[model samples]
Target: MLKRLVSAWVWISTGLIALIWLPWMGLVWLFTARDPGRYSVGRWFRLAAVTVTRLNPFWKFRTTGVQIHDPRRPYVAVANHESLADIFLLSHLPWEMKWMSKDTIFRIPVMGWMMRMAGDVMVIRGDAGSRMRALEEARDRLRKRVSVMIMPEGTRSGGGELLKFHDGAFRLAIETGSPVLPIALAGTRHAIAKGSWLVGRARAIARVLPPVETAGMTLDDVPALREKVRTMIAEARTVLQRELAAAGA
Candidate 1:
């Protein structure tokens, strides 16, 4: 009981601070921009998130299987969506990656501004025109050697079970000939869950599976490629669940 109370307080406070700080930092980055060679500003934004995570007592992030991300090439990375922490956790990845998030997130004060500055793609769910625009922007980013991270599951899952992924991400990979990086996140469900503020500590693991090359693969190969990605991520999901069970809930 005491642990839950402390966790809630810590999470609320951290959110309030981030609400103010993220936008301020965004404006600062805009007026005093220095590094222009970067296509994705994820590295810089991640540094800020790391500081907050270290100070906040609500929960912590753990990672494994990082050696899979190659620093040399851009990748189209996809992962399972379990909780809001998925965003911050993915930022911890070593590669320079961009997120494809909801269009409304860009309307937020600091968070949205920073996302724009970072070149992250935003989508208005269920709107055909908006989806098309987001797809074009994503393709352009890929062509310029910027890796985009997307949650093909589209939204957070209530049960942590694997959800169906859309064909958009796979289609983009086939069109651009970029390798697809399949990632699986485990244990985040316990950190901050769906429709709940209650928090708890869990041993979260991020597994970056080997990249599935799309170099010679054509549009006709998307179906097979999607199935392969689903299998790889599911393997990691099983490992994560087993680890959680071994930890005794």
Candidate 2:
């Protein structure tokens, strides 16, 4: 209980600080950022999130195979959603990717405003018009060579297992002719469980698998593409668990 309190305090304090800093940074980004579509100002918030995770005595975050340095080659990055901590853990990767977050997240005060300034896509679940607009925005981002990150599961699993993926991400990849980058997240479920505020100590791993190209693929291929990427991430998650265990051993 004490540990959870400490972790929770760290997160809350960090969030409060972000509420102050993010908006200032957003203002600066307007003057300095080159492309509105590829604006990376929100990365400041993501970096702050990384710092919060690092300051928490209960969590260790790491990433692998994420050396996508080419600015010209944008991808449709998809990952399994295990816990809310997955967002911060994935941000540790070197490259930048626009997140396709739920519209509700975009309603949060400073954080939401930062997301808007960063050109992240937002979708309202069960709202077809919002979904279509989000898709169109994602496609436009890809065209501008900005990679987009999507959690295909639509929600956190709160467990290590992969949930059934939605078709929107895969369909977006097909429509944009972008490569699908499969990312596997392991151990986040132990860090912060869904529907709970308690935080726990854990080592989280994010593995970036090889990209699956959708150059010649069509809408008819979305289901197969989604399943294939889902399987790859699941297998990679299993491998990551073994690696984490061995490291601890």
Candidate 3:
């Protein structure tokens, strides 16, 4: 219970800090960089998130296999959704990507404003028009050398199992000719369980697998591509869980 309280306090304090920090950074980026959509600004926000996660006493986050150095090679990065903590953990990766988040998240006060300023894409669930626009926006970003990250599961899984993958991300990859980067996350569900507010002590692992090229691929290949990435992540997730268990032992 005390750990949970500490976690809650960390979130509240960091959120309040973000309310002040985001706008100031925005102003600085506007004057100096003149690129509001630049990935560097997004890196600043991600650093703040990593700091918040580090400050929390109940969690230890680690990442591996991230080869995001090449800015010229933008990808359609897909990952499994385990918990809300996955966001902070994944942000630890060295490179920045435009996140495809649900529209409701964009309604939050400071965080949402930061996301918009960072040029993250938003989608309305079950809205066909919104989905199309989001995909179009994602393609545009990829064309401009900005990688886009999506959770193909669409929502967090309660059982920590790989949920059935969605076709939207795969379709986007095929349409844009961007390589599909498969990312696997483990132990986040143990850190902050689905449908629960309480936090627990856990180590989270995020692994970035090799990019699956979509070159010469067409829409008809979306189903196979989706399944292939999904299987890769599932296998990686299992390995990560084993490593985490051994580390704890």
The models' CA-based lDDT, in order, is: 0.77, 0.84, 0.86
Off by over 4 Å in 3: 32-37
lDDT of 2 at 17: 72
RMSD, every candidate, angstroms = 2.7, 1.8, 1.6
Candidate 1: tens digits of C-alpha lDDT, residues 38-99: 44355676665666566656556766675744564678899988887777677677766778
**If scored against the real structure, what TM-score would every candidate get?**
0.87, 0.93, 0.94
Best TM-score among the predictions, by candidate number:
3
Positional deviation of residue 185's Cα in model 1 after best superposition, in angstroms:
0.7
Model 2 stretches with alpha carbons more than 4 Å out: none
The count of backbone overlaps in candidate 2 is: 0
Q: Output the worst ten-in-a-row residue range by lDDT, candidate 2.
A: 36-45
Using TM-score, rank the candidates from best to worst: 3, 2, 1
Query: How large an RMSD does model 1 have?
Result: 2.7
Residue 43 of candidate 3: its Cα lDDT?
Answer: 72
Q: How well does candidate 1 score on lDDT at residue 100? A: 86
Ten consecutive residues with minimal summed lDDT in candidate 3? 28-37
